[model samples]
Target chain A: MTESAAAPSGPGSTAASPEVRRNPVSTHPIASLLIGLLLLASIFFALYVPLYGRLTPKVGAWPFFYFYLLAFMPVMAVVLWVVTLLQRRFDTEAGGPR
Target chain B: MSHVNSTVFTIVVAVFILVTGIGFAASRWRRTQDMMHLNEWGLAGRGFGTFITWFLLGGDLYTAYTFIAVPALVYGSGSIGFYAVAYTIVAYPIAFIFLPRLWSVSHVHNYVTPADFIRGRYGSRGLALSAAVTGILATMPYIALQLVGIQAVLTVMGVGADTTNTYLKDVPLFVAFVVLAIYTYLSGLRAPAAIAFVKDTIIYVFVIVAVFYIPAKIGGWSHIFGAAQTHFTSTNPATGKPFGTFLPTTKKVGSTQLDFVTLALGSALALFMYPHVITGTLAARRRGAIKRNMSLLPAYSVVLALIALFGYMAVADPATVASVKKTGNAQLSVPYLFQNHFPSWFTGVAFSGIIIGALVPAAIMSIGAANLFTRNIFKEFFKPDATPRLETRVSQWASLVVKLGALYFAVELPKTFSINLQLLGGVWILQTFPMLVGGLYTRWFHRFALIPGWLAGMAYGTLAAYNTSSPTASHWASSSDIVFGFSLYIGISAFILNLAISVVLTLVLRAFKVPEGPDETLPRHFTVEATDTPAKERASVTAGEARPAPGV
Candidate 1:
């Protein structure tokens, strides 16, 4: 029933093929963490944010909750993207698939 | 221009054509020899890669209820709706722990459904039947809720009548659903799996654009928050009380912080128990895919967090409030917010996005429920020797029948109350947790014992939910109730009772040396990857043929 038909045939193993090793590369943790922290900081700054100068008129339809929730996507995406990288790193260092 | 402009009509037509085409094409996706097999039909050959899986699961988890309903709750009730946000946040991390294992065990054993696993593990057909019934019942209303979401979008777009009776006004919905049902029956799970990509793309783009554009139009973010604070903190003339906190001001707002935590925790435990979610997870090709995706899927929760905030944005915008008040339908809050602010063409785009969003999940939920009926109830009791083709046929018809059933509920039932029942669906689905999730790690609890516990939980959950009357309906009106001198999530309480019964019954059953069913899983099978072949082939197959889990 599974697509494991194309992979090496094994009854008990549910992992990727042996040669498919390293599980497609991902960005490293160092780069990931830097991006995440920076994004989080931006979100915090934006929170309770008031307009500054001529830009004082908040962009149209850009309400707080809408902005905040919408803003969460990319911020969380970067963080998750980083965590994914870090996890892949750990997975690799731990000797790839079991 | 009196009618929908050509562009609006064209967009709607395109969506309909594309969706219907996918539905038909899905019938042949992957072209399994046994097109009629439950695995092939209900679970889309159960071998989706990461990208497809992501889209499929997204479509499953995030529904039109999610886009329309969550924000509506935010628009209507304020902070209480954020429970959705919190629940979604925890759902993935919790699933990460058990789902991969469930997938592996199911994969190795060739289990078709969660109930199949329960029966194999505990050797109790009765308990499996209960799980099947609960899953079907919970999922039916959920499928119905998607129809309601579709109807809401359709009605708002003027695709339905201006003042027609609700049913006649729902013709557009009925038409779209008939098309959906046919395609689902014809194609099975593949249609939804393929369409999820389209659904998620539209939702992501629309939501992202709305989040940025809507805020800038509504005055700055601070001013929006300021308006919301001023509104919620103000005294309610009718209740003579403050409206509500944008965030929970008290741990015990209707539910204790413990209740909130327990509710979140209980729901996290229950998410994958919903047959559809499992259908999505198991449909994946690898256990690592399941594990890795769980970690990755939290990114959507961030999207969800934003979705929840749209309710607050509705509160802040005076024009938006005026539109919602004139409509007197809070369900229209998010849609009207867009209609009032966005250009007409973009509104059409947003409307289509929401409608498609509902359709993708509706297709999956129907398929999941159909699989449960076919595999667990129909096959187990009606025809043990039923062929894959027969099973697929039964499910296809059954999916159509179930959609019609949900349509009736959507049209006839009080929408708010049934939506509450969809929450009650959580309580129902959670009953299967101990048997399905617990059985994965340990067989300590006797299967028979677990059954009574599950029954007790179901009874108590149903009663507790029924007795929970709010301002509108009597009985089954609210999800919270007092238990053990504390307000708690009814699902958690019932789950505890269920577990207690299972534990006590297991102890009693063990003393009698009752025969337990044979477990198909080898111990190491739970921890390792399941290769395509049986253990016998390891010596003969190509290199890297997975060894049979040693020592089982």
Candidate 2:
């Protein structure tokens, strides 16, 4: 069952790997790199506690730590939004997902 | 009874009934021809677009855990509690890397649970069972924690029976659980998916109101932070140290910067791995919905950051502090803050949101755990010939059983015990990362090796968590322990150990030429979108795919 079901030929050839075979990254390396960097930047900024974990640099009444956390969410939303667009463009250029 | 406000109690009860009615009506929301199939019942027909998916996943993720526990932690421990905000922020980017792949594969193969994908990819029922068991075991305590959240709100409202008997006192909790189970049984995934709209609406309304109004009422953000800093830095008569950190320091003990970073990163990795979160993810109609949600869901974290500040708000308001100090449970801090500051009617609305917040996630969680049981354990081992109808029936029954178990955990065990187990749940679920997430990118890790690696990590995580102690408690006291003299989250440490063993054993298994389990999935399965293959095409292409061992 496992052996035979795995080799499904009809939908397998058409729906699955056409874009992957063309390799979206190889064709649009800069877009892929930007997406990667944007994602990494989002994670890096949030995880690096020391960068925002201070007391003095206050925004309004919030300490720097508190202010930074509240501020970081919108920035991350925008970063991921950009990454999504890049991936969409890259995937479309590489013969699209559908 | 003396403490109960009739107005608040009536309002809360009314809102709860309205939400319950919504839950019962949800079965018809996205009507499907066959409600008995696992995909329809368990995964909401796998047809949720970006909008509903956002609400479902947000309601699933933010939870009562966000509403009550995080504020309570911040109230008690100070800056360390903000790890939750950091965790939610980083979790999106981390999930963005892999969740869409999981979605695509699950969509292509009609997989309803993470364990189903593991079983299909690794071709090892044993490995799949481990993933399934871990998912159920981990989810039980989480569902229990939501009950704890509900109980806290009831306790604050002075709503439960005045009886000295423990079970009699929890009449309200039992009532809540029964309604939840019935609606979930009748409506399946659609029930929670529908109620999530109401849950999130009430939550956003209350949280935004509280963030703005509470601060304005209690002076302002500066005053709240200043009061919190003063209170936290002051010496505690019990411990002879400061109450907690006003700001996380580079010091060796108590909410260090290192501990903060590790907790954030570790929890970010573990968040989406939970079966309930994956259940929410796989329900999306398109893979792109998952990616878009990865960016969109952080909007909730903004509210989470505001909610965490409620701890400081509680500290800043003396009436709230005094009320909570009398109870001696930090969990009451946020509830007391609301009761003390808000008008009776608004307090009722906020309390209802808290109760319903617990319900939405609890429903999703029970369904997720049930799917894992039905797909990987029941059908895999007992009834391989079970029809889709039978699978959905088993899942519905299993969800009821899971909720009952959670009810027992919440009512019988000490609250601290459930809290400790939830912490361990985070650790236990991370052990499945090697198999679930690893198999997504590559199948290089030998399937046989994953079992022992998982076992070793589970064993070490359990014993280590057991040995951890705080000043007030001797066991199950903390989620982070010293590793190489650095305070690190046990989940991250156990995950590293699990990965190391997996790598070493894979090398050994490869050298011995052991048969790698059949790779049932092709690379294309990981990239396929729903529109890529029409339903008729998918059905014909993988004819009899749902039947047990059909090709054989």
Over 4 Å off, model 2: A1-6, A9-21, B532-552
Best-fitting candidate, measured by lDDT?
2
Candidate 2 residue pairs in backbone clash: none
- The worst-scoring run of ten residues by lDDT in candidate 1 chain B lies at B543-552
List model 2 lDDT by residue over A1-98, tens digit each: 23433455545455544534565667888888888888887888888887888997777778899999899999989888888887888666667653
Candidate 2: residue B384 Cα off by (Å): 0.6
Best model per TM-score: 2
The positional error of residue B420 in candidate 1, measured at the CA in angstroms, is 1.7
Model 1: per-residue lDDT, tens digit, B488-536?
A: 7899999989988898888888789776654545444464554565322
Query: How do the predictions measure up, each by TM-score?
Result: 0.84, 0.96
Q: lDDT for each of the candidates?
A: 0.73, 0.88
Model 1 misplaced stretches (Cα beyond 4 Å): A1-10, A13-98, B1-9, B251-256, B530-552
Model 1 lDDT tens row, A1-98 = 23334433346444544333432224245644554554445333322112210122334544333444345445544544454455555445645553
